[model samples]
Target: MNCRTSLSSWQALTTSSERLKKQHLKTLFDSDSGRFDKFSRHIPGVLFDFSKQLIDDSTFEQLVSLAKESDLAAWRDKMFAGEKINFTEDRAVLHVALRNRANTPILVDGTNVTEQVQSELEKMKGFSERVRSGEWQGYTGKSVKDVVAIGVGGSNLGPQMVTEALSAYADNTLNVHYVSNVDGVQLAQVLKKVEAETTLFVISSKTFTTSETMNNARSSVNWFLESAQDKSAIAKHFVAVSTNLEKTREFGIADENVFTMWDWVGGRFSLWSAIGLPIALYLGYDKFVEVLEGAFEVDEHFKTAEFEQNVPLIMALLSVWNTSFLGHTSQAILPYDQALHMLPAYLQQGEMESNGKHVTFDGQTVPYTTVPIIWGMTGINGQHAFYQCLHQGNVIVPADFIASVEPQVALGKHHDVLLSNFLAQTEAMMAGVNEEQVRNDLQSKGKSEEEINELVAHKIHKGNRPTTSIVLDKVDAKAVGRLIAMYEHKIFCQGIILSVCSFDQWGVELGKGLANNIEAELTEENVAYEHDSSTAGLIAYYKQKRNK
Candidate 1:
């Protein structure tokens, strides 16, 4: 389970990959006329075309065998049954329960958690309705006009991405802003756009103690009181989505204004929980429920569909085959729609935070690569920025090309142009230009023999890059929901297949703890402590320069 053992296991799979690589995609397509029919999966309104990936019938059968050997079905059942599969945190990974529309009985510690989830959702609906309908007024007797969501990491990313993706469905009655960075610039720009009397701040943190969020909350409170001149007005303008009722009350938010966040829900997967209050307030409660229903559909598909037909499962298996078995170290998420600009960042956190582990479930080091480095931009933007590297770079990076069959905003010929580029990129990547084609094209362009030789050498593309294209019917609230759920379940399956706990993120804690200690050292004026030479010299230099 150590690094050496993991590397060896991964190395063993390369021989099979090399053999498969020798068989060109053109040959495979010619051999199987129904390649697309055999490789594509249709789930509701989503079409997943994985035919362009570097995979065949034998490769897929082997992946299914790996899933069975890893006991994926049992682990999946344990997760849905409310067992504490996140052993490190000793909590059940039950984000699925948040979208349980069936009201099925799910228990944690002998208490029916399904009831609790339903109750909280009803509460959110009531609150969101009142606020969005102009019934919830500020202390100055004006309806709220703006909502500012304050949270960091998962608390911030998921809702932000969803809201941005489904912006077309937004009611436009109220504007929504999000602040997650500790930097002053983010809050300063947002604060300048709204007045204290009509703005509502939803402070979201599980513990109500995140340093950046609390700091921004304090600064906002100070700015509000300066204008309203009544400290108690904080209760009217600020609400909290947290479990710490004591801290919420102390911060001048009423008990009724404080929503609840359970320990079983993780931040990244919490948009379906109370963390989605901003999303509901911006896009009405009914649209938000549609989002939940969309995800529930994906959840049902994941639970009941066969492995070969399941979209999330197949996506996960493809990722494993590429990263762990084929030695690809990076993955690209290329969304062709411009509205989904933040999706790459959202998936980056979802995948890396969940599966970026070196150890396994039995407290042993893993004997294979865990997670690939996830990075990308919007499809059209990336075509100009990094697609050059993907097409011609030394390392082969697997990519996901996402686009919609119907454009969200259709102008004159713009959507067609965008769709054409989306289709062309994948086709070009799969069937790259060969030497013969390059030479023939150069000759047709009237180039001399010497010029043809030089240009053909540079222009010949070593095709065979692997890519999967996801086509949604449209970019509505429902489609965005299905898209997000697809990737969420994909990360979950990859973690289970790799024999690692995907819910816990202890790696992020170490850095936060170190920052706290460093803050104390930096602020102390008369600090007399033993330090390493490098640290001591840096501190002395800063202090001396500041005194001048």
Candidate 2:
């Protein structure tokens, strides 16, 4: 396969990127009165405005052409059709099947994955209902009141983010706590809040052998065993989401208590599968279904919508235009809603883990950058913290400003204040205050000419920073579902356009493998592994200090 850089559309985008770099975003808006109308798309719950981005109509069309040239449509179809697009893993990418609410029969390896997904979802619904309704009691014959969800990376982030985002809607029947860190502090802190008898542990690991998750699980079991004194009690308090039933069974969970996930579903995208059991258990199963329904809506739209009007496609195009073409190295995900405080962290893992590869599908090194460093916090906090660097920093960082029209909890003037800042930040970033404007404002405030001249340069903001604004109708379960699904498709489209394998995360595996090797050396004296001077010296120093 030819590199994407060799494509005709890629050359056109390269030229456009050079021309657009000299052009200000304010100039683009000034040249067109209908810029917002032309550059925005409206979905069911989202209004995506990219007019503030540094792109013209011709450039946008060329981006759409780039998508076509890369055969993005064909690739998308193969994914929806359950073909093995995850070539590295030799597995079909079928997280979409998990949320196929239409009940479509998606076949993979001669078996209907849609049927399998539906079966697993049924299990989650039934189990969640049993626990929430107080029918699934503890071994001590007491109703469960607390849930400790133990998993790391994708298993932990997706469900924890969803539960935290929608905690406002929870009825307080159960308190959900997530333990992902292997440091033991996070698990210990959560253990302080609930007793072993009334707390349910949902261990989510596809292989049931992820070092961090398994370590936390074992410690949790040890804590529980101290109270119960019988291994059989583990069956009542501990359930699992894993394909490794033998391992789960050996760990004392019953076979019926184990929910299965297929190899086809990548961990980062497994939230919609039985991995979302904690979500269903936290906020009744119906609400969890709403999340799936929302994502399914975006999936259908992603399939049928034209390349020009499709939001996720547009998102991918913008990312490529900014990163690979314009040479931006980082992007910020700034969510204005407090409910979405974890949004940035969740997307950091989602995009980075998926597309943070240097090589293309054929093992050739990609000529252009693949993925940006994804980072940010809630918008309000970021405004006070990093908006300074954003407004006047030497490096340009494109940001996605996300907000909702309705607040989850309606308080007088709070949402209004939040929306005002969200709107102003994007505008200020795009059309920055010039030296003249700053001088005039200072003059009006009764500052002398000396003061005005001295402060004007420092106050001047060269307003051409690119930002995309996303406004949701509300941040409910359905809207959260739509928001995440849109980004999920965006990641998929980005991988196809960049010619990188998005489904495989070998970089993460390399780190995990190294950590596994080093873990034993930490405990065994004189069992040293060869390393670079930096690593070897650090380990030797730690060992010497401990022996002292």
Candidate 3:
């Protein structure tokens, strides 16, 4: 057994798991009238209710002990202090420094990164203001009406998720389009909507060399040059959020138009940096500032709140309890608000990419499951789609149900109806109908005993599926920032508890390197690399068919 599993808290939780497996959440609620009050917490704009999670007071205390034994607080302090905690890369994990609204000086390599973040924020403000106010012009001297954000993975997911979440607040100042897949169809479809002469492209790649991002950037520039008919015009239309100024210069973007990125900020956690330029462009810079402020609030709470009361830490502990102790292998992200429809996809990348490793920080294979298979959709759509599996399927998936108290659009009773479903689903999942309850209901409805018996098994839902409920004030810019920040901190704490290095994604890098080598084999003649027989046969068939 590893050191983590050997901890007193870990052993206690493991010993208690068998009892927890048989205990019903409905029974827990029935025994404690104040269960919700004891289990739920509230911050400024959000209410985090973990009352439905499959745990008792003793279990909760044990989970908190696990966090303490794991040294979560020390790790969090090291990250905030800009120490090189991402030891594999020898870089500091300092996404929190990007939203240091209090302007506290955080140094990395003897230079204050907090000041650097502020400088970049100011630059984003100035540039986004210019674009939104019609001061920034394209090659044709016309104000940019559309913004095309090109990038993949972190660059694409974070900004696009935020923009889509707060899209109702967009002022129609600019229509932002995202092209992440190098599949050509996405970019082709986006390009068809706007004239090249009036559109601005913001290409985001840390090195200006990511394959999908660069390919999409090159194709966009080609389309722009076809219309502008001048190589110099590229400077007026294209901007970049990257550190590689030489590559941006060669690609025809001016030095001033190239924003900055730092090594300390991992791409999955980089939206607070200049990676959020497209967010600022789509929704004015002030709204962007609100996003930062919202995140800063959670950062302060995570830094100061007690472990039992801290929402993010509790989130991490619940996840650990569910996956590591209880043996639940997957969790669902079900948002009742339509504005947060992309939240599942965003978090899938955030959580899975960060903690989807089998090895611990010391390279020991972990005995426990590290991260859950994170998946889900917007609540209404998922109700029709996969809630069947969630409700009746044997695999008991824990879920987070998110909804806002107020709707962004506010049309009549839509918000109430939406919230009603959100409230009812969690209740139904907790207090599922037994065979007796189903039979009683069918008999009350005047169904024959035979009919009731036939339908009873089909309709019977064995409840006790665990879920957490998060209620936001509204799905505005600041709330979106808070929601995402909460999850980000949860992922960080989870990695610490699980003994995995969340900051380094060596898995993603390996696949990227492999794809780069394979690209040459596909495009260049007489350039074949050895592969397994299956892969070799597939490639040979593709090349043979293409030649014909």
Candidate 4:
């Protein structure tokens, strides 16, 4: 039987969860003075403190056993070797190859992806340099001053998040805009701000046929032609990052301007590839390379680190321990830095979309839960919003609190206050205020017994909420890169342990295929098709509103 069915570690964790229910974190901390040191790890430029997580030494050892029994190391080796681990899609999960900074040869189907990645990097560097140096001209013989990147999902989110997250590192030489929405309002607003004379459009789509991306690209072309008034001028103003070279060339993007995206790299994880052109354009190619180098360093560590000391593996195991064994259904990712505001959302898609599966590799329905509903906002804001539920609610939501030790922008005492809140919140979650402590404070304040009795229930907080605090040395391009790669590896480990395919997202496609048919009907008032009762009623209501 598989580990899911008959693993000794699984039984151990199940029993441990039951036993720990009666124990408070305060008691556990009292038992070990060195819990923090024992539970945390300091990597190159980041420190991960999992001390707040509800795990003792025995639980940690069992998680390690889980990894060992699951053959995690062997599976990881298979992924790094570029084997077709994405069995449903028959594709190699090689996003690691995109940022192989050491120029190490990674073979996929006996072909070196590293060399191709280097070639693309060199091309991107050359092209970005030419544009930056005013060598690349727009349709009207002007240097490119603005860039509008058009793509959705991985193409938009990853690159946009990185660029926005690392805005301080940008040169401000170019104004970069992104339009991922299918709605015309976003595209129109972006186009209205930039003149066609000096603007460049980067139409990124792996297939060069994504519905939203192609629509936006076509609209952008029409918008540009309003000024240039020539179809031939399209080549100078537009470029593409797509594998469908034939489609891109037919669309008038020059051969040189059409970059590549391999099938081995999924869109959500393609920021290290040419999909990160906006990042390179705004922050310069060198900084972009720094991001790649940061991720590469983590790749090396993840590849070689032992299970006992491994960061990503430990994180994955903790997630499994919390979600599967402890019955927590959702995880919160609260990043403390303002620069990392997008971190939670980016990770939402990265984790949920990757590992949110209901079936095993052989299509057997899973008896246990897989990925959690990942949700959170900036740490301070979340304290005001959903942190209440995380603290006192019935659901046990394990969270990862990410913050930087050094402020990216040193503004007076702001960083200190942020850091204080960061440290305090995690501590508060772990060691909640008891009624005894609340009553002691109330009595010291000279509150009468009647007033104290009324307030006690509201003031009492049951602690032992689990958390992981990640402290980055600082929020730089490299640190952000390392941070993202760490989570990617964690998701990989998570899927492997859950007996699910992490790389395939057939669930996402089901909606898209349905929407395609629905779109055709929406365009024709008289046309209709078979539909569910709720869907049919909804469509009728929409058409009635439209006709009116």
- Candidate 4: segments with Cα more than 4 A from true spot: 1-3, 525-527
Tens digits of per-residue lDDT for model 1 on 200-240?
Answer: 99999989988889999999999899899998889889999
Per-residue alpha-carbon lDDT of candidate 4 for residues 101-177, written as tens digits (9 for 90 to 100): 77878898889989999999999999999998899997678999999999999999999989888998777799899
- For residues 138-166, what per-residue lDDT tens digits would candidate 2 score against the true structure? 98899899999999999999999999999
Provide backbone clash counts, one per model: 0, 0, 0, 0
Off by over 4 Å in 1: 1-15, 524-548
Candidate that beats the other on lDDT, 3 or 4, i.e. the better one: 3
| C-alpha RMSD in Å of predicted model 2 compared with the true structure | 0.9
Q: Judging by TM-score, tell me the better candidate of 2 and 4.
A: 2
User: For candidate 4, what is the TM-score?
Assistant: 0.98
Better of 2 and 4 by lDDT: 2
Alpha carbon lDDT of each predicted model: 0.88, 0.94, 0.93, 0.91
Clashing pairs in 3: none
Runs of candidate 3 with Cα error greater than 4 angstroms are: none
TM-scores, each model vs. reference: 0.96, 0.99, 0.99, 0.98
Q: What tens-digit string does per-residue lDDT give for candidate 3 at 233-280?
A: 999999999999999999999999999999999999999899999999
Global local distance difference test of model 4: 0.91
Deviation of model 1 at 358, angstroms: 0.7
lDDT, candidate 2, at 182: 98
Worst 10 residues of 3 by lDDT: 1-10
